[model samples]
Target: MSVAELKERHMAATETLNSLRERLKERRLQLLDTDVAGYARAQGKTAVALGPMDLVCCRILQGHTGKVYSLDWTPEKNRIVSASQDGRLIVWNALTSQKTHAIKLPCAWVMTCAFSPTGQSVACGGLDSICSIFNLSSPLDKDGNIPVSRTLTGHKGYVSACQYLPDDDSRLITASGDQTCVLWDISTGLRASVFGGEFQSGHTADVLSVSINGANSRVFVSGSCDGTARLWDMRVASRAVRTFHGHDGDVNSVRFFPDGNRFGSGSDDGTCRLFDIRTGHQLQVYPHPQDNSTPTVTSIAFSVSGRLLFAGYSNGDCFVWDTLLAEVVLNLGSLQNSHEGRVSCLGLSADGSALCTGSYDTSLKIWAFGGHRTVI
Candidate 1:
């Protein structure tokens, strides 16, 4: 065929495929009931008013020499474990801002970290493609280092995110750049179940984040570079329970709502979306107003009641959104003592009294309800 004819034929084929995909999506959505957002509006639902004094930076934990990439709070809510580019994982007493344990990592490129439910151990992973566990109860070596108690290895690409199963230190879940999520038997250091592979219905690109349902440990959601978030059940490793599509860019983070029946996802599209698990429909979309620059969302967390969504952006803006109203109720980045660099990660304390955010400025700040008007 002539060059012009060949190019025309290729363009036509691409258009046909795109059209087909959209039709399928529409058909699937049609089967869902009324969206949650519409129902809320019809019922005249509104979010509680929050003022600047409602939440304030209470403490700043500063010890890392390099950018802080990730952090997690202990279930007891008094301690925090942070991983930094400095190649160190420091466990801090959030109240006193004291470092109780500072251990050097074998791999410096760590991207994610989590505190076990009991707070007795911490898990972290990164470019090493392995999740390393450190037991705080273990004695330090003669070199003054807390050794890795166990390492879960199998991912063919970088380990992007990791989280311990709720109340079960013996099990963990990890998302990887290899476009898969794996459940690991922590004790045996073997794969308990692998979700998504050549024979499975999974993400086509890198799986960047995973959040397990607090209410039901069997269910979890994952965000990926393919611009989709998928719901998976640990019991069924061969296929995803559902695949959610809406974002125009990579889904950077996925968080389970406090109720566990819904989830929130932040994407490179500069938007955060709420999806209902039961109905398989997107309930709401929180979009940042377009300006000269739209920063990517790096991480997100939800308040205990699921009323507030805390999203961290690449421009160092930590926006607190009213989940019900889909409005920016407060900008933690504009507050006094905010981070000087990008907000890389954030999490709420188990009690819902405070929030801890890690930044590229090499510091983590704790924010708590400040005034009499306590709005979590």
Candidate 2:
């Protein structure tokens, strides 16, 4: 074809794409049921302001030579297990900042880790595409190394996240780059159920995070690169129970609210959103201020009362949001002695008395309401 004709065709195609994009945007706006922030404002609602004095960093746990990727608190809330790029999983006493066990991993690219419900074992997975478990009570070898108790294998891609079923250490759930979530039988080291795959109604991209419902063991939510979060039931692995969408970028993390009736998600789009499971509707959006560069949210958690939402960002900021009013209560990252690098992960204690944040700074800081003994 002549250059003139080719140019004309290219311009026509570009115009068509732009028109369709605008139409999609308009459709989304029309489907939104409510503007949550607007409703709150009309009702004269305001969040109780939280300051730096209300949340203080009480302990800094330093030992890892590499960035901390993931962490989980024991059911008792006194202990924590952290996985780092250093190829080691370190179990620490949260109150004392002492390492009780440091097991060298078989794979150095470990991306995620979790503590079993009984606190008797821990599991980790990474580029190896296998979930390896280590029994805390088992005796170490002559070299003082903890041996792998079991390995769950079958994933075709890297395991991105994992969590043990509440009150049941025998079963665990994991999200993977394979675009699926799997429930594993820990004892048999076999797949108990697979939630999504190429032939199933599941995530269309890599699943990055999973949060099992604290109120319902059989139910869980997974965040994916497809810009959606899906609710899945362990008993019905054929399809997701519901899919929630709103994010314009990858959904990086998902966490169940304290009540489990609702869940929150953090995304590469620089927004943290709350969704209701029953109605499959977005309830609120906590957007990062556009003037601040809008760093991607890497992880998120909720206070015990479900009133506060803590979101960690890629630029080393951890903003604590008041869930009801949809406002920033405090920025933990801006406090004294906060993480010096990107906040990679954060988790609230089982009792919600403290919050532990892991960062690319190779350290984890435990923040209590006021001091080490203060409870929020």
Candidate 3:
């Protein structure tokens, strides 16, 4: 080979080596950034901090004259829908802390409320045994009260909880004190499927909470006063596919983990348990130190990544538990400005950036990681 050709090849190899080194350096920096953001999400924060995973009260939404029985955040994260025994369902602008609209129900015993998937409507039900639906764009009456667009009738007892099916807002599921969970088709205003009744192999007592699996919308699980949690398929509502027995008292709340293969339940037994749906086994139980009185878990919510479980107790205590470690990492009740009465319901925002809790004290509190974060 000629000496000139040898020199040219040598220079080419050196340039190639330099380019490879630059790419490797960029990759290392990317990995470091990812590690930091991942740590923040796993620790339930936006940045690395020194304290425990805590939720600071950013807003205390007032105006309800009666107990706030249920609250749900809209998909836009800027609005909230709350139901109260005051016979009103109020939609609030969380960004401005203003009541955007209020609907007066014919029945004053409203218990549960939920925002539809599209954020265009709201559904609520209670002691009237009728689930009422209202459209936000519809014209309001002189009193700023909107008329019910649809009224779902047929539940034999008080409706305890109602939620829209994920991805499909036209359908919803409602649990009732009648010991039944019914899937309703809102568009047709008819019952689509019924899960339990006196003849069905279902809960012997009232069904309190129902959680539909987002991964497979055809399946859902319910917690009942009979001290059991049952999984049912929407197609075959004749009976439950699996029954979980662990809580010694009534299971008040049930929420699906992110993967939808597992679920968490809070019970009157003063214990929160994780159940594996596929294996039909109890994975873990979260129990507090015994005292003279035990607090019943009233509501529960799972984090977006399924790493944390937020549970509200009847004693007005809200706990954030580490799913893998089975530890209470944060206690909102111990914090200042916490609820003074029973926490009836709680929900995590769509973006997982905020949480809202409704209480029997007739108020709702917005909680997040920062102290006094501006709503805007």
Worst 10 residues of 3 by lDDT: 45-54
The local distance difference test score of model 1 is: 0.92
Which residues of candidate 2, in runs, are more than 4 Å off? 1-33, 371-376
Count clashing pairs, candidate 2. 0
- Model 2 earns a TM-score of 0.91
Number of backbone collisions per candidate, in order? 0, 0, 0
Query: TM-scores for all candidates?
Result: 0.94, 0.91, 0.84
Which residue pairs show backbone clashes in model 2? none
Better of 1 and 3 by lDDT: 1
lDDT of 1 by residue, 1-376 (tens): 8999999999999999899989988996787566655677789998667778888898999899999999999999999999999999999999999999998999999999998888899999999999999999999999999999999999999999999999998899999999999999989999999989774579999999999999999999999999999999999999999999999999999999999999999999899999989977888888886575799999999998999999999998999998887889999989899899999999999999999999999999999998685546
Minimum summed lDDT over a 10-residue window in model 2 is located at 367-376
lDDT (0-100) at residue 139 of candidate 2? 94
Summarize candidate 2's per-residue lDDT along 152-186 as a digit string, tens digits: 99999899999999888899999999999999999
